[model samples]
Target: MHPGGIKTELGRHTDPVAEAQMIRTINQRNAAAGLPPFRYKTVPQGAATSVWAAVVADGDVVGRRYCEDCHVAQIAGDPEVRGGVQPYALDPDRADALWELSEAMVGERFDPLN
Candidate 1:
């Protein structure tokens, strides 16, 4: 499902060559928009449908393991961070909160956005 809620169920692609072509098309579109190339991030279980999610890491979107509920964007000057999912007004505070929350998980720096 796309951020706009558009869903596409790519059923079993029996044609490997055709699947590759479709992927190439998607990659081209992403590249033209200055976004990262599309790659399978997760495989959703279902019928013969091919439900794929991409590792979306752009200036306006961040793809992470834990933070997947909301859309987060990369914050400049913080390369260590992947990105955050809040507006500028809530960034600093959210960062502090994430840092505190992460203290219990990983001891790494609380990088909210990159």
Candidate 2:
């Protein structure tokens, strides 16, 4: 799930100064494009969906992409919109290929994945 800018320690690890600048630039672009303002969430809020999928949701809903909500599909994006989901994002073949590539690159298939 895309956690939607959670209050992570990410800023501290990376160049916080640069990330702040980036946020401003991106917000300006989003505003100019008429998109809603982005916001941040606490760690618990960000972890809610993941925890739901792990502990509460049925097997059918596991391993699927979500946005912020548990057991919900990511909002399929329109091609006309900026930052929209691409066709490949929903392609089974592409996903399989990416999985194979990631395992190879990492030099191991994770225990549960096998």
Candidate 3:
């Protein structure tokens, strides 16, 4: 949870130090919950892109800011470029699946199976 939200604060006026702190907070929460720490790679709204890097503990990559449903769609053949730069709470099933996956991925890297 970036304090200012990824979409809300991006671009030249953005604050890297603040964003890093926010990412650290998110990582701490995830670690405490036995989940993977996601290092935000890029945030793009409309067309612009911004990259964020974090020290991935245990080589893990997380989908913290992506819709699990869309992530599933992207994994499947939905013909839609689904993954996005924000977290979404769609339903119980999706949420459960994400939690399970996150737990399974603790201290491990996440390579999308596509």
Candidate 1: C-alpha lDDT: 0.45
Compose the digit string of candidate 3's lDDT tens values, residues 45-104: 222221221322121333333223112212322212223332235355777788678968
Give model 1 RMSD, 1 decimal.
14.6
Candidate 1 residue-wise lDDT, 1-114, digit = tens: 223212245545347798779778777766766666655533333211212224433523333322332333333333222223334434667667767878767766654565
Minimal lDDT window, size 10, model 2: 74-83
Best by lDDT: 2
Two-way TM-score contest, 1 vs 3, winner: 3
Give residue 106's lDDT in candidate 1 (0 to 100): 77
Residue 37 of model 2: what lDDT? Answer: 57
> Which residue pairs collide, candidate 2?
none
Q: Best candidate, TM-score-wise?
A: 2
Better of 2 and 3 by lDDT: 2
Query: How many times do residue backbones clash in model 1?
Result: 0
Alpha-carbon error at 71 in model 1, in Å?
A: 4.9
* Residue 29 lDDT, candidate 2, scale 0-100: 68
